[model samples]
Target: MRKNRLKLGLFIPPFHPLYENPTLCIERDLQITQFADEIGMSEIWFGEHHSGGYEIIMSPELMVAAAAERTKSIKLGTGVITLPYHNPLMTANRLCQLDHQTRGRLLFGGGPGLLTADAHMLGLDARESRDKLDEGISVISRLLAGEWVTEKTSWYDLNDAHCHLLPYNGPGSLPIGVASAFSPSGGTLAAKYDTAMLCLAATSPDGYDALAGNWKIACDTAEKYGRTMNPAVLRCATDMHIAETRDEAMDQARKGFEVTQRYFANQTAHVANEGMDVTLEDLIERGEAVVGTPDDAVAQIRRLEEKVPDFGTLLLLDKNWATFENKKRSLEMMMRYVLPEINGDNVSRQKSFDWQGEHAEEYFKTFQQAAQRAFEKHAAQTEADK
Candidate 1:
């Protein structure tokens, strides 16, 4: 099989236990981002959620800014900022400022708010959220590009509105990615706008299965719109937990696995509904979650790469699904072991073994001499005893 080389990232929804203090959760999240940077992770994505008690972060931009200030080199992104929840002008300006703050290390992800109750609380109809997202993205794109946006959408309006502080990366410097699950809308929008696709549900079997078709749709649509799409722009994310050994990984996952399921059940019915009836084995079999050692993680990633063929980044979904210590160890192992193996770092290690093989005869001669001396000494001792 061909080696699959890919960049690694974290999609920290920053999920915490409802019983745990939110402040502590947020602090740990910051520390994890720093850890990821230190370990050579290419990027870190923060999720924005409003209504979920566990997904307590109201703003990913703030989190990204906080993370960026604490780390260097690791690109920061919004797993998504629910476009429908904020006006385009505000969102654009904040992101542009973040781009500058992070020194052009910002990846902008925009999508419709996922929670129905969140939209409802904001006086937006559940049905209008997607439409609002589409419109908001369109407007935000213009504003970010230093264009004065003047338009009236049902959910929001912008008249002569423009962001004075454009992206530090330059005009159109913002790399916009649209979040999608099993739907084609994300691909369609990405193609039309020449943006990226954030396959948020890439871990799910249904999501994994849709990848090839989604890429096709995005490419064809991009060609039709006289634009070019890069396959590397596609980011596929999956849930994962790795330990020193497969048994340890599975046991640790089992410890807090049900709590995660319950969180999904109450806060994200769409995702929870699919797994509520299945066992952990079933979920792993379906490519919905990965809980094992580094070897298993490598195998699962290869499986995903084979399915998508050219997908770029593998984002590990961050949840409080294991003990905090185990979670840190898992990511460290990924960086130290799995990532290197996948990226062919082991080839360098193999060179030393090859050198040893080349000098095998010399090594064997030395070993034989040492053994003969030891045997002779033992014989002398035995003779003395006699």
Candidate 2:
């Protein structure tokens, strides 16, 4: 068992098919957020996208603001705001305000834009996105810290600019994270900024293989800056659809997974041309997803722990691969069964039950003796009265 309990969260890239009603889709997302909050999910991160029709959320801040109103405890995050696309000063200001709006429950996450098309539309060279992200993070971090920044970049300029509204927790107190996939850049950036690492591709083959290596990179980079990487803030993101049985889970998730894979095939080279043909079995066998029972979800999380032992959070990638009812069921099952088992939440309960069983004979004997004594005393009193 881990010394620290692992936390569960949701990463909503929100892969809704083009066929679904967009309005209802967003509504369902909020409903999911509310349900997750009610069930005690630690956090939920919304994604930002510009051109991808499938990932429809344009501003994760708006989603966070809307969700903040609907939820009570679950911390909301921009799974990532693509830094290169936004002005750093404006981005920092919005985040600081959201930190207040969410009552300090906001988590800031930034990344290089995911879509080449989004970059192309902005007339940005996709190759330069990472460098721009690096620059944006520096500027945004400073602005959020209430520093008056006078910096100029090829894309944007900041002239003694600072956020009027600092974060609710005060300057340099906001929890920030950087999105990391197969590259070491995320780890390096996270180390440089002392932010959390959101391992967005944790369950994927390449990403899984890179997990330990990436953490090592982060530690090494942090060492260079005389800082230590905190494993408690490291979050691993993966796809999962759990039910009472593997077959049922597969049945629920199959069609939607196929649709999502087809969409991926069109958008990214990560999926092959025949990606749509990939089945739930393939996903499970390849270890890319968990489409099974709560036990299987627990096992998958343990597997990730074995790779990166102290990772803080398991962020379920909200692919909407299962129907809404089944999806909710999956999350409930995780909370009721998987989480307790993994975190040892039931250890004391189980021990108390066993202790009572072990002492049952002695307890029964004492109860019998006390009843006999009471009966004898009552008979003596009756005889004396007679």
Candidate 3:
């Protein structure tokens, strides 16, 4: 029963079928962002991908910039910027500019690129990329803080490098989150920097088991680094879709589940490795992918909180594992139903409904009398007008 403000948001890689037009896929993702804003979703995070046709958005910052113009209140974030892919100085400046463009609604997520192919094409090895991630984050953080850094490092050297344009929200308000995908690299960075942690694979059993341990690591790192770690700002993400009924949701999800599964398995092994019997049903059963009714979604989230208490946000992994209509409907149901249930907003409404039902006859008679009076008043008004 650990209670906290459960903010809703989407972590969209903006997946699409290989045969589909890339422009259309990007447009559809933008449309979803606008829709999410209209429905009071607090944030929308876009992923950075280079090689994959399914995850076609190569620049999450660009996508966020476009989404910024379309959305007013919803915060736009880089699902991650893949720090290894860009120059740290340039990243710091670009993100600073984005913070102003977005009117201070930017959450800068730092991570090493997930796809090995993406790194290899850019002439980076795993060791080099991880080192870059570490250095890149450090450099970006310093630049964001308006520090003039001069250093000769492994990858790139900067001579008194500093960002000309600082963040619109001042120095510290724009959040910096680190993405942890079944690894401690992100958690360590988050701790050392005193930033937010995004547990990208928290839905998996291994991920879930490591949740508390990772936070402990973060806490220890924070203590060693003389920084404060706020566990409440940590976000746990999971694949989720909701409908009017569990069977209906599963039916709708079955249409595109395998397509999504294949993409994840092929692209980054985010779902399951090949030749594994991890079906859509298996994911749902394991609390990895929740394709069910709003009630079921609520129950799953409660269970997650039970396992890891006091965690702040539950990020619903946005994907097209159903029809466009079904996907939209699922998000709508999540906002209208699941959110209220988890936040306890539905308790008073349910209580009021029960109270009314207990005195139904009396309430019906009173309503009938009130309607008669209204009708008679309307007739009298008509006569007076005549």
Alpha-carbon RMSD of each model: 6.1, 1.3, 4.2
lDDT accuracy of residue 73 in candidate 3: 95
Which residue pairs show collisions in model 2?
none
Instruction: List, residue by residue over 3-33, the lDDT tens digit for candidate 1.
Output: 3467889998877887888899999999989
Candidate number achieving the greatest TM-score relative to the actual structure:
2
Each model's backbone clash number: 0, 0, 0
lDDT of 1 at 377: 100
Cα lDDT, model 1, residue 174 = 88
State the number of backbone clashes in model 1. 0
C-alpha local distance difference test of each model: 0.85, 0.92, 0.84
TM-score of predicted structure 2: 0.97
**Candidate 1 lDDT (Cα, whole model)?**
0.85
Worst 10 residues of 3 by lDDT: 268-277
Candidate maximizing lDDT:
2
**Tens digits of per-residue lDDT for model 2 on 222-246?**
9999999878879999999999888
Better of 1 and 2 by TM-score: 2
- Candidate 3 residue 191 Cα shift, in angstroms, is 1.2
